[model samples]
Target chain A: MSEATSELYSWRASIIKKQLMALTGLMMCGFLLVHLAGNLLLLKGSDVFNQFAYLMVNNPIIIGLEWLLLLVFLMHTTIGFRLILENQRARTKAYAVRSTVARGSKFAFISMSVTGPLMMVFIIVHLFDLKFGSEYLVVQSDLEVRDLYRTVVEFYSSEVNVAIYIAAMCATALHVQHGFWSAFQTFGLSHARYNRLVELSSDVFALVILIGFGMIPIYFLLGYS
Target chain B: MRFTLRIWRQAQQETTGRFVDFAVEDIPAEMSLLELLDSINRGLILESADPVAFDHDCREGICGMCSLVINGRPHGPGAGTTTCQLYMRSFADGETIVVEPFRADAFPVVKDLIVDRSAFDRIIAAGGYVTVTTGQTPEANDILVAKENAEEAMDAAACIGCGACVAACKNASAMLFVAAKVSHLSLLPQGQPEKSRRVLTMVREMDQSGFGNCSNEAECEAVCPKEISIGHIARMNRQYLFAMLLSGERS
Candidate 1:
């Protein structure tokens, strides 16, 4: 192969794919933290949450950032699926009976295959449900913004909708639990002294995020409509 | 100990392979797993049946030639122990043991229990060595490597090329093996000159050989006979990223 073409072929290397996955995954994790912080305003009631949502959508800078986030999400999901498909192709014949005995959590390890596609589908449905669900997204006279707070509450108030939200949140927790520390490992941040700390902090972050978003559905489920 | 065996049987790479059942009686528990296979092959020879073909050399375990997936775990159940080091005593009497070759598209079954692992050789040939002049022997103190780096390099150098990591990986990824090769040499002063180009060529070769991407499941570390850590893989990632970005290749 020519030098230029070989350099081009290097981009298809498995390590490159893994690096892209880690980079995009960490970026999405950052977005998750910010999104969770904003969602917490749901606990402060409708006006505060609606106005926060309004600012997020209407402000030009925030809108630009939102577009950037969409691009990040697109990259993450695309690379994620590519890795999954490539991995599946690598192992053409499945073992008749297999067992994975490893140091890491098995659920977290295997859940990547499950949670990745689940989260992608959920993100799509979620975007539609919140961002463009209804034509009645006009600014309310009192709140002076779109009633996103009411949209969230209405979405979560249904038993079926709340159930789906909770299930998706669990998947998100599992995905983050594995991906968080793993992203650091991919970036060569794994030190003997800090490995355990990274794992512990990742677990804590996953749980906190899970409960933070999960509570919104519980709040509306408990006759708070 | 008497055990029923379900061993994969194939004539060649072109033919489909399947598990065939055999009963072995009056076997001693003190025999190593490979020795047990030897006895099974001995039985087949006496019966005029085709014997099982597996790979092994320097059965004391340093050669990394022994490759077997015993009861679905690569190199058997013992952590950091190769199949040659695994003994029959570890199994219960009358236990059913299923044995097969490592399953991966990159590893084609050469016979019953042997798969062609020359893919690893090709990957190594792609860029596992440093280019240097060989003439007069240089003084031992010519290049002073840090103690920590030396130790780390030694750790990475322990990889046996057994292909266990590939077998253990759910994705059949060889990142651990390739990382070991890359990190060991790159840790030293002698290997520095070719560091960037070496990593690029080796990694590209690995992908071309049809190995899968690592998902950081760490099954490779768990099953490695040398106990080679997945940290090597992380280090390789760092090296590869630094090389790619520094080389100005972004896609």
Candidate 2:
């Protein structure tokens, strides 16, 4: 193929990958919100949270949805990896000689190229630690949901893990802070009034995720009985 | 009022350029930006310094020759206003203004604030015309065009071959300029004979000219004196795709 054809093909691939990443990433954000809500049941004591975990595990429809979520997660990660590589290739030059003054939203959107991958690594480690590790899935019993809570608490009690979690949560916050509103802009849903609403929503969601996730670790660190 | 002007000066195409500072006094607020520069040039001539050379014609803003990056914006701060139309009143008194030529790989600086935008001409020369016979003039309105289509074509045709869009773009992309030309001619029935070939050849020439790809950041639109929408870009992409597919069939 000619160089133009190759460039065109790669450009089209990057555009498609961006669309896939946005769709799956937004869906995963929804999952995170729901997942966090379910996890918060641990604050109510072991029985309440374990019952919630039991319902999720026992429902056949929920089981199918879990697989769907897994598929979306994998698709998101694969496309995200492709996007990062393409972005790097597009910016082969070391630094920009002429830097334009970009709006705040544009700056945050561009920086997503960096934070997306960091969040990917955090997601993998998180899944491995809680889902595949000795907490819940290895035991195959709803009772280990309580053990999962204790493991989470114990994990956060460490300064290193707390630091990592805090850092990861901060990355997540920035990612969602830009991602949420940007998705709307990409889809052409930007009116001035609605644009402000989307911006507000992005900030609120980012704050909730940062404080919500960060607080979990701090809760244990603070000796919450 | 006196104003400090940081103007880029280059002696030749191969010579390195630098910002040379000059102060101009007693400039009227009603004076357009080009007039302000003229005042500075007059001062340089008196001082036996080489007067700055720039391009301008038809100070009415139709000629598209007055291209300058004023205050870090293409055509200054006025929306949908050409540089020649921007008056000194828009800027603060005694303001330090930086002025430079439009920088792009396709457009190289010739001297002072002037750059050779001949790449656009070459892209147009590639295939921007209709392949109609040159015998006799056709009847008036021989091809019935819809009013909306004619209006859109006129809007696109209003582009005066200015490199403002390219200057305003962060990536220095010329997609808007190419799109406007292609769209203007492609929309009419008289130009239909060579529409597909025109888009394909012109787009190929545009790419070969080393202009960067359009990332749809809308900076071009923001600073476009014509206020050309990026929608023209989408239309251009669609037209190019159709041309490619049809040209493949012809081959």
Candidate 3:
């Protein structure tokens, strides 16, 4: 990042910042998709869940991927927060009476300024509780794996943990509701006729992420297999 | 028609302002909002009071001079029209109307219901034109343009530079305004010469002018008097990204 290169991007720095936000956020969304698939294995009970967890833990490139995921997450969160600050500077004075046009998702879309930071805080809490809280080892065959299923179940058996997880999932869902389509728009994939399809899929995506992850704590707490 | 009007009055940029209510009677429905203001100003002058100061030109809505945010929406209630084109019929009799200047960090209040929109002029001067001189409207048939591209270019060219997009956006973003200016040029063959350079320069100018970034909300489109689509914003995004990537390696 030299002066000349930085100057080049400064010509359209706002668009560049937006594109960077989209790119990093898109990578995290891809990870979320994969993570949702992995988390679904919990419903299969202890052995099945532990088997998937074993594969995840034993992968050779897992450390490299974890670093990359962390980097992407940090970049996304940092840019989003920076943009929020810039937006504040952009409008130092507020209108005495301001109103927005009638749009269904407008409220949720603007709520990204609030929900995005909440998602970051929630991610830290989530990783602390589930990823690094404790590890239980169990053997089924000739090898042993961490019984993450038991850890997850025991963690969610508490009302506080379930409440926090569910609440955070709602924020995450609100973030994706706008982020999904906004990413495509930033990438220049938006069109008049097909935008409805993209917007529809964004809503569906948000709902799936909300329910798919939200059901886990409830399922574990209720002792439902 | 009789109505109660709440109008913002700022004596100067450094001075604070508040709403002053005026009651008007026997207004004709066919009278344009500007004429209504004219009558109000005349009455004010008769009473030896300061007349309401506003902006207007061409009264037909083409000059992009009229600036007013009536009842919270820029250019009043009706769609695809400017403040000068707004008629008294748009509102109901005996209703109370609130009028304010177009609010933004860049466009500050000049007086009663007038904001300095000169930032748009600077943005346009950045690169919103084709340097290639065609001298005059030399035969339109000579340079062939595809029907669809020509239509799209015309659509983007419809922006009036009213600054309503910024006023309507929650972040006060000028993306719709800049996108319209960028897209109007990028679509034509004449604009192809300076395409990359134009978008880069104009968008940079817009950001430096203290406007916020678009968050993909369609509120700008909803309030745009010319009905400029956000599709141009998408087109501007594509143009901007490709321009950056193509010329990025040089720096």
Worst 10 residues of 3 chain B by lDDT: B242-251
lDDT of 1: 0.86
Q: Tens digit of lDDT per residue, candidate 1, span B1-251?
A: 89998999999999999999989888888988888889889989999999999999999878989998999899999887899999989999999999989999989889999999999999889889987789998899988999999999999999999999999899999989999999999999999887877788888878877888888889889899999999998888898888878854443
DockQ comparisons of all candidates to the true complex: 0.52, 0.12, 0.44
CAPRI verdict (incorrect, acceptable, medium, high) for model 3: acceptable
Local lDDT at B183 for model 1: 93
In candidate 3, what are the lDDT values of residues B44-121, reduced to their tens digit? 999999999998989988888888888889888888999998999999999998888988888988877778999999
TM-score head-to-head 2 vs 3, winner = 3
Q: Which prediction has more favorable DockQ, 1 or 2?
A: 1
Ranking by DockQ: 1, 3, 2
TM per prediction: 0.95, 0.69, 0.93
Q: What local distance difference test score does each model get?
A: 0.86, 0.73, 0.84
Q: Which stretches of candidate 3 lie over 4 Å from their true place?
A: A1-8, A102-110, B134-137, B248-251
Q: Report the candidate with higher TM-score, 1 versus 3.
A: 1
Candidate 3 residue pairs in clash (backbone atoms < 3 Å): none
lDDT of candidate model 2 versus the reference: 0.73
lDDT of 3 by residue, A1-225 (tens): 002232434633888888888899888888888899999989888898899888887787976898899999888888787788878877776777766783425453347788888988888988889889778989967777888888888899999999999999988888888888888888788788899998888889899999999998898888785
Q: Relative to the unseen true structure, what is the C-alpha lDDT of residue A209 in candidate 2, on a scale of 0 to 100?
A: 88
iRMS per model in Å: 4.1, 6.4, 3.7
Candidate 2 C-alpha lDDT tens digits along A1-225: 013442222223222344456678788789879977986776776556666766787899989989999899899777666555543432232211233433334543356656778888898898787666555432334344435665666667788988988999988888888777655544335554566787789889989989877787687788783
Please give, for residues A66-129, the per-residue lDDT of candidate 1 as tens digits. Answer: 8888888888888787888888888999887677877655464446988989999999999899
